[model samples]
Target: MSEVEVVVAHRERATLRVGDVFLKIDADPGRTDIEVEAMTLAPVPTPEVLWHRPPVLALAALPGTALGRLGEPSTASPAAWAAAGAAVRTLHDAPLPPWPGQSLDEVAARVDAECEWLVSNGVLPTDLVTRNRQIAEAALRPWTPVFTHGDLQITHIFVDGDEVTGVLDWSEAGRGDAHFDLATLTLGHEERLGDLLAGYRADVDLDVIRGWWSLRSLVVVRWLVTHGFDPFAPGCEVDVLKSRL
Candidate 1:
């Protein structure tokens, strides 16, 4: 019998892997629905949906290892990172999905609230939060919305050698800023940005990408803490924030 591996578990959702199949348990069925629809619409490679039963959605595992993880150096070749970037660009170029993404105002409000919490609670130094908040402002400007894989974390991307095998986690997919996806993929791995941009083959504002790095790191710290994750770990979120200095 294949052993069941707990991939990730939190109050909102849990994913389990048994043999080659992954089972996703989400508190909101709507998220799963969106994931399914997004995968179907995405032009890039995505996991094959084995089945869906309410809260439990089963998916066939992709063939390759993750592109990389946050706080860790990626062993993937530059070509592989570029391939991942190419895949992202393809997704962005695809037709927009039916659902909309969070508005700029909404994002700003969240950043403000999170910064306050980080400072008031002494989670992060006030100066650090303040500077990052200032930097985050750059990302708040108007942008052309594209189809985005809203949570384009490094671990969600898979690569085999120099080719992108597949991308995972589509629940958060929607129409959003293209730079947001770029920032998310390159977070904690700034050195790879150039390689990625080469594959992306589009002009982008570096400041906005940096701003997103700050904005995303700040907003996620609280959630990580509440969810029993350690953002303060070496080379993790805190380190990413400190790099902004």
Candidate 2:
């Protein structure tokens, strides 16, 4: 029998791997529903669903290794990074998902609330929070919606050699801003942005991407802390924010 490996386990969800199959257990079935549908709709590669039972969704693991993880240097070549970008473009070009995503007001409200919490709780220095909030404003404007992987963390993308093999964790996928996906993918790995844009082949505002980098970092710090994650780790979210100064 294959030994079970704990992939990720938090309060709301957990994933276990047994041989080549992964088992995702979420407290909310709605997230699993979205994940299943999103994988069905995405134009780019996604994990194959082996089976799904309520809170537990089983998947066949993709063949390749993850592109990289936050706070860690990527061993993937420039071509591989570019390939991931091209795959993201393809996903963005796909037809929009039926469900609506978070609106501009909703995002702005969250940013406001999170910033206040950060300052009040002393999670971050007031000056750092203030500067990042100012930067985050650049991303508050309206945008054309596209099929987006809402959480396009490098760990979610898999590449084999110079080719993108598949993407994972579709629970956050929906119709959203294209730059959000781009920003999420390149969050800590700013050096690779040019190579990514080379394959993305689209006009993108660097400032807005930077804005999202700040906004995303500010908003997620509290959650990361509560969930037993280390956002303050070296080259992670805090460092990503500090780089803007």
Candidate 3:
């Protein structure tokens, strides 16, 4: 195997190339378990940066790296999306570990920590509390907890043709509301998003999915703040976030 290429790089996490092996280095002490656990939604092989005294994640590198893939939709919709939706749903429905020992408040607090980090990093707007409160009141309701792709989106749905080869970046997976995953796909591009959500709702509720959408927008805004408003990648999503926010 050849050394994997460091295709995507970030301030806190740096992807490495080590013979078809991608290692993610979390160079910051502010990392948390809530973030890294998000990657399990996909069945692909991933390695983590042991963030004790030194934290890092070593991910298995996938074949083929598209330099300009994010600029446009790589796969066509309908069939491609359908396949992707199924792949995610399968993960969402998988038998997950019970949370009998944990409290809901603890889980919510974890999310709050990430949200706070995002805000302080300039990845999220200063009005996070107000925005989150509104979303919580409107969208958070009775939900059968399942595996959520915390950051599911077209960008994260990696594919090899009509087949969803894999879902990338599981740094935010957990037994939470499934709407977050559905909203990540639908909220912005309602027409196309609706189709995707429709595909997802084959297993869950679409009406109560708005909270996830709002939360997804919050995440997108954070991406925009941390990353410059790139017209191609996050730019498209940001535009949708602005309209909805």
Candidate 4:
């Protein structure tokens, strides 16, 4: 058997590399989206219910940022934005049955709980939740719900030239409010968000999506400030998040 070594650890999962295959184990019980590299284009068996979401096996990995190869680094380009947009569109369109465990509210509550811990620990300024709740509630209004990537951000997309090859992470994939997904993207990269929206279905309200961005950014700032920038850590994401706030 090939040995594995931990490459990265997060709140919910740990990445282990064995030979050419990367094993992503969810910290939570009964969650599986493990990906194994396939060499040829062949039809694989339908994934068991244990497989969690259907993994994207063929998308080529891209290079740019250390976190994920998301579009053009720092500077925004049309081709890059379009690539990111197309990637997300593909990810969102992938055929997968509902996740077996964890409800959407549970996930939101998990985020809220993490924020609450930060507040209780005094890492986040007091009144952080109060202010954020108001913002999120206001932003969440005026949008219908759809299946979302849940943690969709520019950094999750892999881009090359004018084409998007893949979306890197899928641990947080679920059915939820699509606006929240758009919001998270817009909040982090406001300048390039318009380009992403352009690739999405035209019926979506950009204003509402922007509002979600504000709320999502607020939560992210609180999390990074309190937790010391673990997600996409060691990079300038913490600095960027702080700049937005």
Candidate 5:
């Protein structure tokens, strides 16, 4: 048997890899419930839920390597990106889940609060925060709610030979803005967006997606720092913010 290995250990949760099985432990059982349901409902491939015992949920490992890692160059082919795009498109078009996601007003308020904190602490230049906030306003308007992966990042998708093998981390899945998924996927790799959008074949508001990118980067910086992670790492969240300036 392979030795158990820790994949992630954050304040809120932890994931351990043991042989071909993954064990996710969280403080809240409701989150695990959502993950299990989302996996079941998603049209795209997802890691199989092996079992669940209270806070610990067991999952079978998926095939293939991650499509790409955050804060690093993507070695995945353009076709893989396209496949991921199509998978996300399929998910967005699927029927809505029972739960509701954050409303646009709630998101806008969070963005505004985060921006104020950033400027007050001198964590970032005032001009940079202001400009991005202006751009972010485009995303705060009403949008038709669709199923979203909430945190659909490059690191969460697995691919092999231009095919999406699986998607992981579905605790945040719910009805929300579709551009949020697009923005989350293309956060730091904006140049590759065309390849993904080409595969999606659905028209989306580019400006709104860009706004989500800025709003997300700004709000997450504080959380990352508090968790002992660096947002300023090369090609990370801070870098994405700087790119918009």
Candidate 6:
């Protein structure tokens, strides 16, 4: 038997790899359905869906490594980063998934709640929380809904050289803000934003993208900590948040 490599094991979900197959075990089957459907609809490369039975969905591994991590530098070339950007544009241009993601109001409310949580728990300085909340407000404006990868972290993208091999974690695919994908991908890797944006080639509101950087960093700390991941680790989420100050 092959050793089961734990990809991620959180309160609501877990994923594991055994041999060449990755099994996603989710708490919600509906999300899994959405993932399978999104991959089918997306024009870009995606892993072959092997099978699904109840809680577990099997997927074949794709070529290459992740573009980068949140806190670490990406060794992928600028061309590769641009390729990622192009791939994102393709996905955004594809048909919308059946579901809908958070609206601007929903996002604002969540940020507000998380900010209060952080402040009340003394997790972050009140001024820091307050400042980021204001920054986050910029992203809370109306956006033309597109098919967005609700979570477009670099880790979800696999690349070989300058080309994208495949993208993973389609559970969050839905109609949402385009800048959200850009912001999510470039988080903590601000230096590469210019390269990515160059490949993206469409005019975007920079202020909102920056707003999401602050907004996303503020909201995710609690979840990461609760899941036994250290958001405060060097070159990690907390470090990214501190970089803004």
User: How much lDDT does each candidate structure score?
Assistant: 0.95, 0.94, 0.54, 0.49, 0.92, 0.90
Q: In model 4, where do residues sit more than 4 Å from their true spots? A: 1-7, 17-20, 33-73, 90-96, 100-116, 127-129, 217-245
- For model 2 the local lDDT of residue 198 reads 88
Better of 2 and 4 by lDDT: 2
Model 2 TM-score (2 dp): 0.99
Over 4 Å off, model 2: none
Kindly list the per-residue Cα lDDT of model 1 for residues 153-192, writing each as its tens digit: 9999999889999999999999999999999999999999
Candidates 2 and 6, the one with greater TM-score: 2
Q: What TM-score would each prediction reach against the true structure?
A: 0.99, 0.99, 0.64, 0.63, 0.97, 0.97
lDDT of 3: 0.54
For residues 33-71, write the lDDT of model 5, one tens digit per residue: 999999999999999889999799999999999988778
lDDT-wise, the better of 4 and 6 is 6
lDDT of 2 by residue, 1-245 (tens): 99999999999999999999999999999999999999999999899999999999999999889999999999999999999999999999999999988899999999999999999988889999999999999999999999999999999999999999999999988889999999999999999999899899999999899999999999999999999999999999999888877
Q: Can you write out model 3's per-residue Cα lDDT over 11-78, one digit (the tens) per residue?
A: 76766777755566676633334445444324532333333233665555443331113335443556
- Which residue pairs show backbone clashes in model 6? 71-235
Let me know the TM-score candidate 3 reaches against the reference structure. Answer: 0.64
Candidate RMSDs in order: 0.5, 0.6, 5.9, 6.5, 1.0, 1.0
Could you tell me the TM-score of candidate 1? 0.99
Quick one: best lDDT, which candidate?
1
Across 29-140, the per-residue lDDT of candidate 6 in tens digits comes to 9989999999999999999999999699999999999999877889999999999999999888887777888887888888888999999999988887887777888898
Looking at model 1, how many pairs of residues clash? Answer: 0
lDDT, model 5: 0.92
lDDT over C-alpha atoms for residue 80 of model 5: 92
Structural RMSD, model 6? 1.0
How well does model 4 score by local distance difference test?
A: 0.49
Please list the residue runs of candidate 3 whose C-alpha ends up more than 4 Å from where it truly belongs after superposition. Answer: 1-5, 28-54, 63-74, 98-136, 197-204, 219-237
